[model samples]
Target chain A: METMQPALKNGRNVWDSVNMPKEEFEARIERVRTAMAGRGLDLLLVYTTGLTDCGDTAYLTNFVIRLTRGTLVAIPRKGEVVTFFEGSSRGLPSLKQTLTVGDLVAAGDLPKESAAYLKETKVNVGTVGLAGLKRMPFQQYRTLTSALEGCTFKDADDMLADFRICKSVRESDQVRRAARIVGKLTMFLKETTFEGASQRAIEAALYRQARFEGAEDFRMLLAKPGREGCSVGPADYVPMADGEKVIFYLGVEFERYWAEAIRTFTFKAGSFVEETSPGIISGFQQLCAAMKPGVAISAFCKKASAVMAGKGHQALAPFGLGGGIGLGLSEKPLLTEETPGELKEGMTFALRMTAESGDNYAMVGNTVLVGKDGGIILNVEPARPAE
Target chain B: MSDPNLKLEKTLELINKKGLDGLIIYSGGTCSILGPSYLTYFCEARPLGPRNCAVVTKDGRVSLLVEPVWDAPRMAAKAWITDVRGTSRFTDDLLEIVKGYGVNGTMGLVGGREMSEEVYAAISGKVKLEPTDAIVETLAREKSARELEIIYRASRIADLGFEAFVGCARPGMREYDLTAEMEYVMRAEGADDIFILISSGSHNYEMHEPTDRRLKKGDIIIGEITPVCEGQFVQLCRTMTLGEPAPVVYEKYRMLLHAFAESLAQIRPGVEASAMSKAMNQVISDAGYAKYCYPPYMRARGHGFGIGSIAPGGVIDDNTKAAFERLQAVVVHPNQYIPETGYLACGETVLVGINGIQRLAATETKLYVKEV
Candidate 1:
């Protein structure tokens, strides 16, 4: 008899850098079930749709729906979890290759299918937990409620949000990998970008390097100096003039975990060069310094405001500090004045802050892991680029 | 030169015909494929968030409501509707707009599925709600010259993507590497959005988002490269052989080519869309693969490609009943899984013309054999 090699439990295996081992997922399920049991929940239904809402479902199943559609995963207190997605049943062969969830069902109408599955499982009457319900289409929510008439549904987005806010060792490893790819891609952007190069081309180049490094999803938003309100996806193929400020807000998901970075570049003469803002850098540093374990996010916000004020800028208006970055581009525990959570140990955040002086606008961000000792900056580049 | 005014006039005409007070075209980002976001059609705007609703009154007054509340500046810049308002409170803001338009009488709803039950309940009692999906579909069935130009440009971008697919399909690279390269070429060429799926193996099942599986010698590569410009989508289903494939592979590919050719021939203005599927399926069935033409073996012969108005619906199986209209853009793929050659891809996007089908892509539909 041949002896089998033991499953490795270290930093990113070549194959499983983004995707953790089954044991990690099993442990997560145990944590979730414990929370659900305490809350007296019979089943937990995690509904996610479109690109932005894909994190909650990916956190549990490692199954992210790439298409612009709705997908749901139902986890009962006892039985196996099942996934329902908007695709043909024939596509199950492809789904199996991507996701580990076995009982996959093709759903034309998500709520109807979820209701039918709930009825079949004899979970007709119990307190149901609904995570990511905010993003669910109102039509589906009504249908789901009407179908499970005897059951009670409660908003449990915080349940998963709280669970996913803190990163495990393996999850942190995945975010670091994603951050490394973002760093390399941003560096490439700084080198190859030139005048007459369209936003589409610059974004395409970023995608090329990131995908080559095995990124699952790449999202970018472009804006000019005065036009700070960036839209989603690539803009028209318009060239930037020399001495103009061009901002690229980029986020990439490796495996299912996510990390994001923001950088501003100027078309100086003939080439693109990294631009810096002192006010933004000062505020960003203050936020990073305050990201200690057991500290409230509100305290960090106050510190960030003081740094901005001391730097001759106004108080931080909670406009730019980023949120949690894992499984989703922006998760719960957002670093804002109104955010309710504290910085816990094992938490990871994408610390981004922006400041304005005169007509110029500057933004900088980096992914950091909150450890027992202090915050560990996962990104290779600093929060703000050096002059 | 896209004409948002002309599209809006056509929508108003449909509302007048339907005997409604006005129309509410709802968009839930990319999720509403069934009743797709017609905002891009009427206002030349694509939504960034989950929900964006446009209310057009009978008096030519149009008000738009978008989510995230922050994208108002961007949305207002793109849309001609001056009464555009961004909202974080979707239901409340939209209700105010609907009431402000004095839409108390019978009203037409273009995207019924996009509206939640709560919104429906809040407004249905105040007005007679009529689903105007067919009206919107009819108006969008015929594309304008500008729309056709955009579709043509999108097709050109897809050709570049296919070229990159061929260039990047090396032996040792992962499937995602090829996908990335292809996407890079298309994006650089100015494709606003992209939907790429790839499968590489000797016996492939279906094209999906590229996995980390590395390509090897004699691997068969299948790619469904879709590039979107403005709102028009152009797709190309292509299969390439990594090395000199087996004789059986060539024979099966030829069968797919025949099916593709036959299907493209049936795509005239007057022909029903199902006829194209029937013609394509017939070619495969006649090639001693009768059992492989149905589900689990194959899916759609083609689907309509657009953001606002994907007419003839998204799927064009043998049971589809809609007829092809002139200027309508659709992809006619006869991708099949056969016992002899496994899954092979062969398809191209075409414009339904008065005379016959006009091929949109410059790339010929045939098996590409890459030498080892």
Candidate 2:
């Protein structure tokens, strides 16, 4: 759940044509243009920071900033799509490697440069749609709003979100690849002797292996559930004591798609054994059985809550039940009690379950595919119930 | 949370001096090695969630509001402030705290660039905002004894990371895999975070995120290895050769060594920060590549680092206004580009002390050539 720590982006970063080709982005832009026409928006300005919120921009243009800066993809009603990022012009050689958009401009200030583009292209008088405007830095937002005097602004976050909720064939493949990389990460953990090793030793080795397996980005949060304090990221690098139960929440983003999974393990003897609870498994399986293409997300959330309650598992408010995953860690059609949306086929969502395991809390979940036939659990075989 | 009282005491003094009702040290969950979290400077708690802020009013009342709710317990243990709460309802809770204090006239805002439209609007409805990044900058311009220790430790981690780069990098290894090995060594050395950029090829343009591009025998692997320890980010820019033998590569890297040394010679407690860059640029210019010293080829010759103030700021080019001050932690690099070698990295972090400059890392800045 602690997914917001700033990423170093120290892993594999590329725009693989085989995985997500330029044709995909071209189709995405065409669809966005059609959507803009429906909404009477002459230009759609998609915005996202370089952090976990870079889905909208990455969805439209395969470009993602490695640094903590702002990026805007301006898709006009027609003409070549332009990408603006907050950086120096020198970054083009590196940025152009991943950016599918043709017209890339590096600016000291994205808002100021975007405003200049708006005037240069005579877009100030046109109705513009802003996606992910709320997430933009206030300084940039202020600059953008103040610079464009005659522009009409409309919120297109939902429109862009609607487009991203359902993954295409290529997008689903990316997620599957991401999930497979996650499998390698967990496999490395099981194979290595990290049970009694220091936390940093295990984390460093695990991350190294994950990158070798082609992880673009990685995040992990270990829950020493019965420990003294929250102990975020194991600051002291405490050695894992024998027979200690811990939940390892790993989110691996391969290419641009994210595949998040939570696994529970108990260190016994000299090896780590899976301790995923039976209740958590049965509860998620029931939800999978209930899922269909047209099922409402609210109903899914309701079922999840009821099913977990029956299994003696409590929904911890801090770590959410789970949400849709694809381009973003959590995208539209999020699983929440009040989320108003319907699940569609090809939409991927990760479901998480938390249950008290004796003296400690254990968690387990997997990336599930909202299939045309039924819900498909993407990865993570449920381990045997702990004695 | 070492010397939290010192920071709080300084902040309170500034509040009194500026006649402000209170001060808010905020973190938008955007922590960079260059510009770290200001909230961490004030309270020593690196915020894991977005919109983590601490309110320090004039009456000595302090409250820490963190998002994600789960991070609150960890923050509580890390922060000296006892009033730490994991915030669920963001804007409402923040406004409530501001309103409850009856001190909503003019509040100093740190980490203001991180604020979003909603947060700025919600806070602006109540108080006037004063850009107060300087408050923390002033507090951090001079390092404490503990800060120097952390800076050195972080620098040592950077050294180890680069050593890993030297050991793990070889022919057929992907760029990402090389970085991962480096990150592993740094993390084992207690680095809380790491930022690494790598470029490998015959003619490298710039260092970006690690890619699947494989390193070849003659590839020049350039890496900007930064390992952050307790938010004290130390960067080491290095250029390595998979196998020796390009005369131009050796010549260009040696020129960079001269530029870096000249830059180091220009550091003092009273000189302009731009002077170091100018001195470095002059050496490059004397080498007959003056045109490449500016943008599109070169970035900041150096930058400052700390959890709080990254003073002497981003680019220490011809226009940087900040001056070199005593005990200021800064990274001096002569990372440059030439048509011959594409680009080469050479630099190390240092402490500008009262006596002279203190090099933090034990690794010497030079071209490290790994025999194939």
Candidate 3:
């Protein structure tokens, strides 16, 4: 058995050092500033709490913290960006290490401290936009509202969400990297012959491998062959059997970007016991081929459903089809009946199609980025069919 | 037949001994299960939905109050208790049910710290809510045969994870990739919930979250993997050296292994949980690594693992006073910090038997080495 190499040291990893070029970051900021001006907003207070908030914060400052508490990115209309993080004086060193010199601020005063800093920096808060205020706790909201009493706080969460919906080349690269890792692991699991292996053992192995491959955070949803439950965590004692379907929702974080894919595996060669119909393979292919830039998401969903219906497989609920992928495992450009927009170039999304043939359900999903010409599949492996 | 009621009787005896009027148990979603696990130990079935509360009185009249009106019927059918009521709004419904039961007198609230401020205010205003760790601790400290069966099964699953790591964990792989592979296998096998914390480095500062760092030729990857079975938690902490470990790393491993052994040796019925922690600290301190045993360096040596109670005893330092009881299951990791090696993971789950402790998981004590 060959020993593995160490991947982390002194609280910093390779992902921490991966930087989006300063020029590109400035360009994104300039785009956001233009949007702000069009919306008649003087400033944007882009707030994020816990691990989920890293996207907005990283958009302004290329910093990401792994703590459970929240961080706020205060983007003024005309000045440098500042961030307020949770913790005491002891956290300053780590704060400095993770954030840039101009972006770090003590969290003790929080909204007050942050608001005062912005005022001192000449932020005209008369027409400020606030994103992620719902995530802000009551106490923090009170402090910020008290500090910027004269400022009008309008919701700009939609603006931030819209801005992030389009993926940059750098962001696409990270997503592709994450997708490649998932592809390799999925292939490995298919080859492992999971009969008699308990759920806990399988989960432990996947977690170890994910860490070894540079995944910062991992979330998985696993369903056994016979048990078609919708739980997110790992189950214990349940063993793999000969003719069951396993739905695996795998997500990995690379450089603060999240990429997710869902795949269903079976252990035997046969259609589902009840339906005896062909699986969702053709449907998935049809959806993938139909998905193109400038196409309406609802139209895409309708086409996918039509393909499944033509194949005599039960079409999945429109909501179950996947959506955009980026900072969060699930993002915008959602595939729903009332989806309001069209797929744009540079937008990345998970093309998930689920079909039920008799008693068994088959799902195939992959992370793909919208290219000028067509859809660029991030993880380029064909779906593995059960033997 | 070994009486199934023995555990419940023992729990009630402990409740009387502690002089508590009643225990208020609440489960907040599946992730937070302080309420349901404690109630389920006496009764069966978990409360449905995100929020559910159960009050087990001294007279054995158990009342289960849950949010989401649809889940009440499911809760009633699953639990043996008769008084199960479902409420649409949690705070208002919770107050009315408690008031109806007249449990507003001196009552002990288990798992109330994580409750929202609105729930806390409602409960405190009506009843004198005293936070007690005893409610879940007494029932959860000792594992039942059924609980043990689930935990043992969970350990077997963890062992599969070990094998998977050995098979797939290689240099150049990203951390999340390995995690995804493991998760895929676990889910394929039928895992419900898994909590995994992994670090890869020769000098691991702490067993923090996973990162997207490609494994290097000589990185040592450590994982603290735990799978929550039913309501019980079974954990396995193991460290793997990717390539030939540095001599200094091996030395630190030996020291940690010895420290782990010393901690295990100290486990027995009636021993103060804190004493075992202190004894383990002494093993490291005597070796001139005292600073590593405390904060900014190392968090806790180990903690209790079970269905409803962690009985963490707060980082088992010298002044800690939590005691170990018979049948209690605990995980003691000699997770030490040294300037040479950041944090080396080594631990196991042990059941405090009548005589001594029995190891649950089937992992070897020595450092697991995988040559690159």
Q: Which candidate has the top score in DockQ?
A: 2
lDDT of 1 by residue, A1-387 (tens): 000101110011123624578778778888889999999999898888776667788778777666667788888888888888877776777676556544778887788887898798786569999886555666787888789898888878788877888888898998998988888777777767456776666667777878777777777776554434433333456677778776667777777777877787788865778877655765666667677888888887677767766765542222366678888777778777788768898888877666656666666778888877656777774245668
User: Tens digit of lDDT per residue, candidate 2, span B159-263?
Assistant: 899889999888998888888899889988888888998899998888888888889999998989998877788889999999994998988898999999989
TM-score for all models, in order of appearance: 0.92, 0.96, 0.65
Clashing pairs in 1: none
Q: Pick the candidate with the highest TM-score.
A: 2
Residue-level error in angstroms, candidate 3, position A183: 5.1
What TM-scores does chain A show, candidate by candidate in order?
A: 0.87, 0.91, 0.85
> How many angstroms is residue A207 displaced in model 3 relative to the true structure, after the best TM-score fit?
6.9
Minimum summed lDDT over a 10-residue window in model 3 chain B is located at B28-37
Question: How should the candidates be ordered by DockQ, best one leading?
Answer: 2, 1, 3
lDDT of 1: 0.75
* lDDT at position B231, candidate 1: 67
C-alpha displacement of A283 in model 2, angstroms? 3.6
Model 2 lDDT at residue A271: 66
Model 3 over residues A8-66: C-alpha lDDT tens digits?
Answer: 11112333445556666678778888998998898888776545435777666666655
User: Model 3, B28-108: lDDT tens per residue?
Assistant: 434321122554454555543545777766655567886555456556765666788877687777777667667646777
Model 2 TM: 0.96
